[model samples]
Target: MKHEDMVKSLSERVPLLKKEWLGIYRRMGEHPHAPKWNTLCGDRLFEADLESVRSFEGKLQKERLNFRELPPESIILWCSEMERRSQWFESVLNGIDIKNDWCRITPMTRRDMQSKLEQIVPLDADLSRLVVNPTSGTTGHPIPAPNHPAAVGCYDPLIQYALRMNGLNTDCSGDKVAAIQICSQQKTIVYHTVHSYLEGAGFAKINLEQNCWRTDESSAFYINDMHPVFLSGDPYSFLDYINRGIEYRPESILSTAISMEKIVRDKLHGYFRCPVVDMYSLNETGPIAYSCPHDPSKFHILPNDIFVEVLSGTGEPVPEGERGEIAVTGGRNPYLPLLRYLTGDTASMNYGECSCGEISPAIVNLGGRKLVLFYGKSGKIVNSIDISGIIRSFPVYTFSFIQRSDYRCTLKIAAGGELTSRSAKFMKEKIESLFDNEIKVEIESENILLKEKTMPFICELEL
Candidate 1:
């Protein structure tokens, strides 16, 4: 079936399933297993989308049988091919009136692309067939990034490459994929989506809040029954699942969206007993780097499509192994050709070949958008990931926590309307418990728009 036809079929069926699940939940009343009904309903709904399920199954067979052996030399050749095929590169190389060196053009930033998205597109590009993907506004402002279907097709190879690097087989004949991500006003949106390469692999997206499930145990049981082969989610969602005592293990787990801290990584590894792959990706630039299972600290850059550089504040390249802003050049996204785009991330680079025998430059000491550190009772600093899980539990439009001191903090929330006192009290209690009641917590409703660049948790206390 065509993608459009399948989408239409699923679109018609989704409403019916939602209505059915609502009735089931209503009938179950306050029973312990009421929430499990949603999960089961989602699974069945996805199964009904026969086209996507079959497509994904075919993709899995291909991935398992065919693995591309990408070495350093092949990566260099691939980068060269990308430049030749890129219209943006050609335009830059041929300056306004005369041929100019590629280096003469300044690197582009996310802000630059946001302002001149059309100018960056190749002169010969066909925009009608391209997909417009908007960044999730986690950093500061959301930007619409464009990509051709062919460019989007490159994800499978990179994913397979990462899997191969970790010594995990790409072929999982009949296993499904469970992806936990944020959904707008939906407890869970389950559907079967097939990748170009991994056709027929089951895919489901679940939201991780009390609103999504009746209890943690029900969610855990539903996951175990589905028997997903691969599980992927943001750090906050995964942490919530871990805390919920979920023991169903998949072959591999992918952590994306935010930087994965050592504590979180350790806990995930300890509980899952599987390779926890940390994927360094952005909406603008897909699959930048992936953590090596052998050494999670060392991330092998996806040299085929992305060329990475670490630069100082002044735009000069930083010394090897020194932390600097991450700059990227060359990508498959023709609509948003990134020419030395400064990705608001800090990481050092190691030129030395990795122990895994891949010679691609590795990003070390990866850090994300800076967030103010909160001090705990014993003066221990609290990372942003430590509190994100707590904040995410609330059904608010946007929220932020400002830490004034080790003993006091304020929670500002924008729920689009007046936040009920009961909900506010519940959030306050959760925060207080997390801080062991040593810190005084205050909840205030505010009209604030959370920017992608703004850290949700900010500490004004001077250490």
Candidate 2:
């Protein structure tokens, strides 16, 4: 208990050294490289191009990577290494001599885990194996993910490395971070305003939450004074800042907390005039993998920290190049030991050798949880993301379009900024081009989860 109290106190005083103190304790925690990564983390998001980041649709259909390439004898060694990294996970997955409260807390399902989240994860508790297990929430429900400090050791470093892949924070850096949709200890609110999260102590860069970026002089204070590296934004903001009356460029391009289409990414690249890259991750899971600059064909898993499996609906492992559900074996957060955990999303592996040439298995065609895109006058055809590419050209990110009726299509968007004549016309033209003469675009901007209140990419009207 004395050690626990001492470590917690030290963490609060020195946030940067959080993980190190946890490592010294009798009890071990998970979330390898968490404190270190969390510090470098803290940024906003937007979507990216190709409907896919690294893989092409044609190749994902033809090739998938195989797990057989990995050594079978590695599990024992891997377990040992993981024990050093995430003791909480090691205790749960592999039997450990956890006879005390320090390591033997019963794992929780998403439901029972909430109340104890903070109790388990003390702000001062670095990596003493007492992380609040976060739920993957993929069973259309949540799984209890216990916090792991050691996992963060490597996981945090991986984040910094991936950001460098995009040329971010070489020298210029800041303290402020932004988010379009922020989930705190409280409710999920559309993090539209920059000042909402900014209290007395702010970071060095701006974490631009999606909503409306204030066009006032105070925004200029953030631009010139804070000089935040713009983490992410919609193409509308990245491209039409001239209409927005501010011409600020960020140091790096951090994409994906929201869905930014290929069209928008092209414009964002123009606006930042830098390497704009997107990563695959969710709020529950920190950045899991990244796009290797040398290979746009596949994603390299942070294999040092995570174990990923592509499985079919029946929980059977799918062959390379075969579409299947993504199952996560190792999570950076030991508080969350997501073993054989099913992620509702779908994807495949790269069977072919990647042009970039990293030996890590290339993950391609993550295709689950997607709304099937249907088009043509009678709505008789299925377009999927391929035909739906043009739909992403709009400024608003949250939207659902349907054509149950022949000529007319109902366009529902999450509401944020009230559509002016200019914005509305832009909306109508986009819908018309896709469905043509009979197409009618109804800007419901409501109906779905409130856009102003979310960071949902494209909440397609479920067919």
The C-alpha RMSD of each candidate to the native structure, in angstroms, is 9.3, 15.5
Question: Estimated TM-score per prediction?
Answer: 0.64, 0.49
Flag regions of model 1 displaced more than 4 Å.
1-103, 173-190, 214-216, 369-463
Q: How many pairs of residues collide in each model?
A: 14, 62
Best by lDDT: 1
Question: What is candidate 2's lDDT per residue for 6-117, written digit by digit as tens?
Answer: 5554444333432432332211112121111112221121122111211222222233223432322333345455455554444454554322221122332223233334
Q: Give lDDT: candidate 1, residue 44.
A: 21
lDDT for residue 198 in candidate 2, whole number 0-100: 21
